[model samples]
Target: MNKLRIGAATAAVLLALGTAAWSLRASGAGHTDASAPAPSVLTVEVIVPQQQSWPQSVQASGSITPWQEIIVSPETGGLRIAELLVDVGAVVKRGQLLARLADDSLQADLRKQQAAVAQAQANLYQAMSNLQRARMVDGSGALSAQKMEEYRIAEATSRASLDSARADLDSTRLKLSQTRIVAVDDGVVSSKSGVLGNVVAAGTELYRLVRQGKVEWRPELDARQVSTVHTGQSARLTLPGGEQVAGQVRLVAPTLSATTGRATVYVSLPAGAARAGMFANGTIELGAQPALTLPQSAIVMRDGRAYVYLVGSGSQVTSRAVSTGRRHGDRIEVLSGVDASARVVASGGAFLSDGARVTVASVGSAS
Candidate 1:
């Protein structure tokens, strides 16, 4: 009976061991299947390039100034300022009276000149009569030759004196006419340096005139940028209040400033609107060129280098180092690295690794 029990126990032990081995094998297989990486599911954005027209533009800043400026000064000296006709900020026409010198002394001098002229005329008439009388007497032999010669000499002297006096009178009259100050151009008076009752010297600046109510914007551009700007290019002016005025590039300096590496760009504003010394900003368009562009978010920086992930055949991710150009709005220009026909990942590119399989969630449309 003991041998029978031991045999039954041995048989039971073997059967239990076999069942445990089978169960362990099944669980190992299940774990192995669960650990095996299913194809990495990656979310990506794909972009296909399309050919389109793009414009290249350059931007710069500048200020506004008067197109022309003139300083009005006195032409003659030693005149007391009698009346000021125009004040600062006053609009004036060409040849309009701006001021007047004290004319009391000038008027007296003018009268003196007129009297001198009348006296010269009377003297000339007397000389003519004396010459005629002397000739008649000499012809009739009633007067000696020496006496006729003396009378002729006296008449010639009187005639020369009369001509000299007339010339002096005309000069004085011209000087008298210059005492009134007049505007040299059609403009506004920007400054006034003289006042009534003040004595001024010749050529002293009495008023400042800004011509034609126009202004010039002189923008400094770098030497490289100077070549892009040209005369007659369209320009727009921005003021402090965001007001914009249309203008045109009128002049470009041929030389560059050595100190600043810049050249002057001149723009002309319309009349009766822009004033001198007003601050202004402007922009000018250079020509256009072909370029490949991508959104700023599409570029990825890795290990101190700029790169972008490209989608290959079957949505495989590949990183490519790229050279970029200027930024246009939210997009940047691609100078090199990616070809036009390739699909580029636009978003979620940083999470991608080389040769990683990806599934594109959205395809970007070309602009």
Candidate 2:
């Protein structure tokens, strides 16, 4: 009976030990699975804030236009256009012939005037000869006083006719020269309204030119913002196709727009493939400023508010609201609400929430 009791107690003890070992193994497995971070939670790119010298700029949108658009018109009327020498978008120099008119009728009038001048000269010679004979014979009564006076009048009348004919000839020559329409300044032809065989009138617009191939960026800004811009300030423009153009502020409008109450800012750009009437948005750099900035992709705009995710211990991310200012390209300046040393999820902040767990794929600084 004593042996049976001892064996039974030993078996019970062994069974208890086996159960405890099994529970320990199970607990270890459960702890390992619970502690391990899931692979599919979320991955994000992280960045640290950097100190940079960023340019202070004014932002606006406007059209690229000509510095000066000169309208070329006809000075002489009633002539058919015989030739077109330039087309739209053609580059031309000052005094370049842009078009020519038919000169057949003009030449005919010139010839007629020349013939009249010749006839007047011949008449003047005859009258002068008569006047001389009358004066010589006046000593005798053969030439009366009335006849000499008439000879004097005839000489004067012929001389007057000769002067008038010469004046007419000069007028005809001037008219003939006007048959050619020339450029008044070096420019690019922006528009051409005249056609071959079409008769144009005086004061009729034939071509519109962009004088000197110079372009300007005219941005309309509010009155408060316009005061910040001035001549000689440098600017940069970005086209829709992602091309960048540099320019300088040339003028600030003295008056405000009546409808929009916005002031105009004119920025002159260098000669290039930039065309007038191109719509572009750009910034006029006021100067460089010390700032803490981050990549634009790092900011998450929600409900009209901008937010960023700050990295915490154990790959946790916290939502942080930041004040942004002076944005350029893909980088944005942080005005406040973030520390310079804080590591932020540069991108994929939209996929994260406050205290969200994440795995960082890359770490860098966006200055």
Candidate 3:
């Protein structure tokens, strides 16, 4: 009976230990099943392309220049500049004196011409008296026909000499007036080449005037772009110092440059808006056009090409290459790629890959 009882105790102890081992194994398996991680999904915001009234424009870079540069030169030669009334950057009006030349010689010539006129008049009066006296003695043999002819010829000659002297006097007066250099039009002087007491010749440049103080922008464009631009188009430019100026197209070059294959488009700006020879960047307004645009953050650049992410039916994103156009503010023009109805990843596009699974964030969720 004791041996049988011991055998039963051993069997019961083994069965208890086996049951405990099985229970521990099942508990471990259950814990592992509950703690397993799920697949990762990137939460992102989505947007749809919309139609907006974006103004059409062409971007160009060029330099500022004077609209009309007038070269001021002396009309009379062999005269010295006695005084310079205007210097560089001096504003002047029409017919304003800019410089003065010595006029003493001209005044002296005027007096000499006047004295010659007086002598010629006196000779003319004597000849006229002789002719009159001869005519009174006609048919009386007091004067010969040849003598009367001589008196008439002398009177005509003296009258001609007097007219010549008057002409010389007028020329002298004109030269005297020319000694006073004056501005041709209202303008601001840009450069000065005349020096005080310096003798200058006729047609020599004395000063350079920016006519009307008007400045313009001259931007070069390719053959294709030149065809689209026309005169009277609205333009806006940013100066070198960040000042904005509005302007209008003044002229479009009829012919392109043979060497560079480019043409210049002239845009007229207001006076004092910008200085000549300044580099500027501007846009030519080409009217309004409907554009399908998206936020700039929605587009991503890779390998020099542009791309955008498109959401698919299965909550997955696929990258699509796109061609872009002009950019306005924070938005960019989508020339071709996805349709207007397609949902696109608005931001965080740089971190996304092709065919990546994504979770759409709620509209009111904090990004």
In TM-score terms, which candidate is top? Answer: 3
Query: Cα deviation of 339 in candidate 1 (Å)?
Result: 2.8
Cα-based lDDT at residue 237, candidate 2: 93
lDDT of 1 by residue, 284-360 (tens): 76656777888878889888878988887777888999998777787778888887877888877788889988887
* TM-scores for every predicted model: 0.81, 0.65, 0.82
Scored by lDDT, model 2 comes in at 0.89
Instruction: Compose the digit string of candidate 3's lDDT tens values, residues 26-98.
Output: 9999999889643436888888887888887888999988999989888889988899898898999999999
Evaluated at residue 258, the lDDT of candidate 1 is 87
Candidate 3 Cα errors over 4 Å, as ranges: 1-40, 131-149, 361-367
For candidate 3, give the lDDT: 0.89
Error of 2 at 90 (Å): 2.6
Of 2 and 3, the candidate ahead on lDDT is 2
Cα distance off (Å), candidate 1, residue 49: 3.8
TM-score of 1: 0.81
For candidate 2, lDDT tens digit of each residue in 1-367? 9999999999999999999999999999999999887553688878998788977788899999999998987778998989889999899999999988899998999999999999999999999999998888899899778889999999999999999999999999998998888999999999989878988888888899999999999989998889888889999999778999899999999999899999989999998648898999998888888989898888999999889899888888888899998777888889997988889888877887887789889888764
**Candidate 3 worst ten-residue window by lDDT:** 358-367
